[model samples]
Target: MFARVAQEDFSQQALYDELCAHDQRSRAGAIVTFTGRVRDYNHAGAIDGIELEYYPGMTEQALAQLIDKAVKRFSLTNAGIVHRVGRLANHEQIVWVGTCAAHRQDAFLAASFLMDMLKQSVPIWKKEWVGEQAHWVAAKGSDDDAAMRWLTEDKDS
Candidate 1:
């Protein structure tokens, strides 16, 4: 498992290749990946860019824990998360999550679980820019609800 929070951008293809490499013995039969990009608009207005900030060591630790949990919970052979922190223009990549498992279901579920957990638990902040104004992005109720759904499902499983 690997987790990184950086100001520099990451290559999704490179990360995908690395996760694929985890199954050198041809054991993992499925690989799942998710990419999150900064959109051109939000609820308020047209977004020029977004500035992401995090607590450095604290944030990386939190992300690592999430990755570790997903790997164990989903019986994944490998998992990775790369989150970009800094000012990013619209359409720029913000985050990537990848999972490798023996089954497609496990890989897909782990990827989804990591995303919801990251949004709900990670110590990262985003400020969206529109023209001459900027505002801190608010946590959406939908995001909270999605995370809660995962929690409920995990309990039943």
Candidate 2:
């Protein structure tokens, strides 16, 4: 029920607890979470950190829409997404997705779907600081493919 695109880091556990405190918690049997972290290396070999940027209002709206879609599609009790912007060191958390559902299958599937959609559609840009040089990261076709899988599965379900 919460979506935030901010410059500060988030606590995965806090996100979990927020879902657990949902009014419909008694009806939820499964809570699934996905945390994306910055690694030391990408295609460029090694990196020091990444600088993320996004238009404040638009980014938050887009994320809320993604979470809303997941909630309705999966019959989720609650859901939340938090993505970090600004400079972040390697190994720091970059994104988090959490879903609460009546069953394990729904929770897992929703989490996966949200993550894929976020990567595919979100306007958040990333500039990786690789050694002394920086490069704007490009979108991967793999992310598009993964998000497409959910669209196809949505109709089937």
Top candidate (lDDT): 1
Taking all chains together, the TM-score of candidate 1 against the true structure is: 0.94
Model 1: runs farther than 4 Å from truth?
155-157
Model 2 per-residue lDDT tens digits across residues 1-157: 9999877888888888887887363688898998999999987588999999998899999999999999898888899999999999999999998999889998998998899999887889999997777889999989889988987876235
Kindly list the per-residue Cα lDDT of model 1 for residues 1-157, writing each as its tens digit. Answer: 7899978889989999887776677589899999999999988668899999999799999999999989888998999999999999999999999999899999999999999989999999999999878899889999999899888887224
- Residue 132, candidate 2: Cα error in Å is 3.3
Output the worst ten-in-a-row residue range by lDDT, candidate 1. Answer: 148-157
| Full-model lDDT, candidate 2 | 0.87
Task: Tell me each candidate's TM-score.
Answer: 0.94, 0.93
Candidate 1, residue 141: lDDT: 99
